[model samples]
Target: MLKSILLFSLICLTLLTSKAQSVQWASKVMSFSSEYSDPLLGKEYRAIHILGRPSKYPKFSATPSAWQSLTPDNPGGEFIIVSFDTAKVVKQVAIFENFGAGSITRVDALDENNKLYLLKEFNAGYAQANGQITRIRLANPTSFKVKSIKITMNSLRVSGYSQLDAVVISDGDSPIEDRIKLEVDPNAYLVKENLGTAINSKFNEICPVVSPDGKKLYFTRWKHPDNLGANKNQDIWVSNLKDKKQWEKATLFPAPINNEENNAVCGISPNGKTMLLNNVYGKDGQMEKGVSLSFLLRTGEWSFPKPIRIQNFKNKSEYSEYTLAPNGKVLLMTTEMKDSYGGKDIYVSFLKSDDTWTEPKNIGAAVNTGESESTPFIAPDGQTMYFSSSGHVGYGNNDIFLTRRLDDSWLNWSIPENVGPVVNTNQWDGYFTVSAQGDYAYFSSVENSMGAEDIYRIKIPEKVKPQTLVQVSGQVINQLSKLAIPAKILVKSRVSSDTMQIDYDPYLGDFSFMWPTKKPFYMEIRAKGFVTRRENFDFRDQAKYFESVQLLGLVPIEMNKQYKVPNLSFIQSKSEISKESYPALDEIVLILQENEGLHLLVEGHTDNQGDWDENLKLSLERANQVKSYLISKGISVNRIDTKGWGGTKPLNTSTLEEKRRLNRRVEFSFFVVQ
Candidate 1:
């Protein structure tokens, strides 16, 4: 009876769990087309390839000239809604062309009061005859707050531009959401954000990954005033939110997890048990900021960092900055591969079941180029990949790009769309991360910053999001030469040599390291032309301005002679040297030159490579070789006494090889006081 009751209870739990997985958020429309076919395969591949298109495209009809409205005033104008608890959070509306022509003259986004928030006027006289997706941004949009949005277009009156065709609308959750929306989405989701106790002294935080139970939040804070000491920089910080509505101010995460150095976090796994961070603990006990990053994992109250294996390290070089997937199994970081798309491509390493990292593979040509691609953020669905790219066609420098996984590949990308006017500016914008639910995004920028660089929180307009990360950095330059040598730098445990290890960029000579505020670690760097540098750092107890410049150069090997001479003795009182002393003949010649005008008795000794008489004869011959070399170097023949003793002197007696090798050596002593 007890067993039956337990089985029933387990079944009840299964049903409850399965019911929770039914919830899902609407996905954005992404498409592509092959209107311009391959010039090489015309007749063989006749059908036009379909680029991903919105579901609202009209059905093809036999009548090519059917009457359809394309203006914003048209009832079917393109629109999409982000919903929470069956209510609208925000709506993104598109109205240009679905299957026809459209030259957009002016685009405006309106709120409930019909007030304009975005008024973009464009002269698209060169718009193609093919359909295009027009984006609109909405404000304060909530699960029920955002009512509706409109898109207006003006048709060009010239033959150069195509005629405006139709408009369409969709209903779902916002393309981007926040912690609250994500938790309430399909499944048992938990998304956390920054809640500060202080207002503006120095409030910087991001990448808040919550545990599956939704009790803890792990994040990173940089340049906070409390963290400003003689060596303080960036460190991992954490907080807990009790209940769904209450959040506490963050505190320095536990010890053995942090060091007196800079630690920046990049990605966190769903369980919150492990996360990836970049750390720069210099060999001189200094924390490096802005260019060296590595990975770390958390266990109980302690978080430890271990360097990526087989990553090359020289005398002093840097290579640690990277991103992590939600599962903690896919690592996306910058590296130099021979066939790289460009500057720094985002390569991925999958964690195999055997606990070893798979060989890193590049994301390939579709999303990468000869330009820099970095800071990859993979959404929970494991399909929507967000990253920053500089070479892809976009509106500004280093624009953020989004791509959908098509079957097994990611070639089907939305024609790189700018995050519109609100999120993008003329300056640099990269290094961005998002909540699991796809609502809110965190990024670092100087646009409206209070200092050199500050982190910012943005409630994205429903249709777009900023790039995944804003690169925070400085570079390593030669102190004496002031020129950068793309060297490889390393960070390891001075105690066990098993902790975090990473390599530096050979191309840029830069590094980006992130870590937790839990443990103290030792940093060491080695390169081809410099001495190994060492430093100690504790994140749990940090210092301020954790920055340093390491000056290093090649170390030369020193040659001196408090040199050990061979045990040259007579064999059983016989005066002769062993044969093994021949190798030391060169040293006797060196001794004569080093001490000019000095005379020497070349004594050879043997512990017993053979019997007494045989050892003595061999030692004699060995001693003569020394006398000959000295004479060859222009030393006076009468100033040298070549003598040998075999089996008479012993350094050690366990074996003949060791004793003979030691005793059958050439020695130079005072034959005549010089």
Candidate 2:
């Protein structure tokens, strides 16, 4: 049994000490009756069912003798108040009558003035004759709007009583079209060639499947011009998108796919790693009544197609096609169901971690109607669903419908709409599959064709469409000298830690990668000659055209040393002269500027070397030599502190030339946060 789980919706709440904002309904009631005579309100009013019982109608028409209200046990007439607000349009209307099939005379939607605006009175099916529920669908009804809906009843030839147990009215809206947008100007390129002959051979052509990186395209061709098989034969063919925009002449996809039997390619994984197609064959080894589902693997040399056993394939007439999610776990399919709305509805089955398929479940009434719905394809994000519906409102035949997944449930599904004059005419418009980037829409259409439905491509506008990726790019460079540096850069998402690493060309010093554009990420770089650096980039807050490039200056580890040198020099005036010591102090200034984190304590010392008081004064003077150079080079004084240790502490306890040299040296250590 399929599990029926109740859904919890995310609700926005506002707290209030007193009774917060809320609605108070006087009461809830459902009124169901079978009679079509008088209008209840204006032309807009059809049948009114108020929340609470109101005063009786001024002139209530006699209830038809054949009409009766239904409850839980009687099987049809239980009407539930799904909502009490005004509705603009009713997409579908369902009713249950007691008399078995062919029991009702007619069902019509009338205005409050008793004028019929729309009607759908079809022959009662087997289920309807036996007191089962019957669903009636109307074409787009935008000509008039109403708050109430009326259902008129008429008995069969032998005028008998008509009973209604429940009435369900569905709110309707038009389905949204696939939107595709170009990142750059459209003048950037044009279709060098359509390569229609690749898949067009005087037979029906369709289902163009493009590879992940936008390199290869796989499509279905029938009665292929290059085939040795009989006429009306079908085969899978592939074409390459060379030089970015040009599609190479298409050819039969490698073996095991272009078999003697009719093989139709349905969809391909974005990565081009797997393909799903359906094949029909019989004992004669040609197109037959028996159609088997299979998958093709791109194992270096394309492997033979393998059959799928998803527990739902029960008959030769049962149809099934695979729609692979970008992540490769969700598989959307179609099959005839005993409990289906009508002929067929799309279903989804998830692949478990153990590699087994789960039981398939209907996409539910939100997307599937009682009429046949099939050809399911999910956008790369796995949030938007696109399919074809014959029962949906459109220009003609099958029209495309799209619905988005919200929270854990799919809701707010737009009604199916015609793709306009370009993609649809009076024929079937389906078997649609789109690229991850949402740039191109490929489907079977009979447009400027040599024969039956030829594969056609349309560009999806960007504003309201889906996208496959977010691009990130930046430069590596020396922080202090402002020079570009080439290094290995790795971008890791804080949540997933999935790393996309790229090495900058030693000369170019630039790197970039296409990161999934929905999260926070950090970039880190490591170089052999410099310090490791890291930067954080939050894509969530970035603009649509965001890009980043950074420069890092690596600090070289300096050695601690002891040295004897000439007395630090002071030039010109007595208070501001240190000419001889300038070169050595300049080197220290460069080091500090290169490594921003570096801080140093400058101490002055005299060679064992002098009178206590006189040495102290001289030591201070030498320390000033280092400080002045740093100040001239933009180094903040707060970062450098000076102290004098005059002749007090000596090195090596010796008075030799070497001892004096050691005692006269300068020293500094690194101070920085980890």
Best by TM-score: 2
Cα lDDT tens digits for candidate 1, 438-513: 4455554445555444444455545553222211123444545665544444444333323434444435334544
Off by over 4 Å in 1: 1-219, 223-225, 241-247, 280-299, 310-320, 393-395, 407-417, 459-674
Task: Tell me how candidate 2 scores on lDDT.
Answer: 0.50
Q: How many backbone clashes does candidate 2 have?
A: 30
Candidate 1: lDDT over CA atoms?
0.43
Q: Could you estimate the TM-score for every candidate?
A: 0.36, 0.48
Q: State the displacement of the C-alpha of residue 532, model 1, in Å, after optimal TM-score superposition.
A: 53
Among the numbered candidates, top lDDT falls to: 2
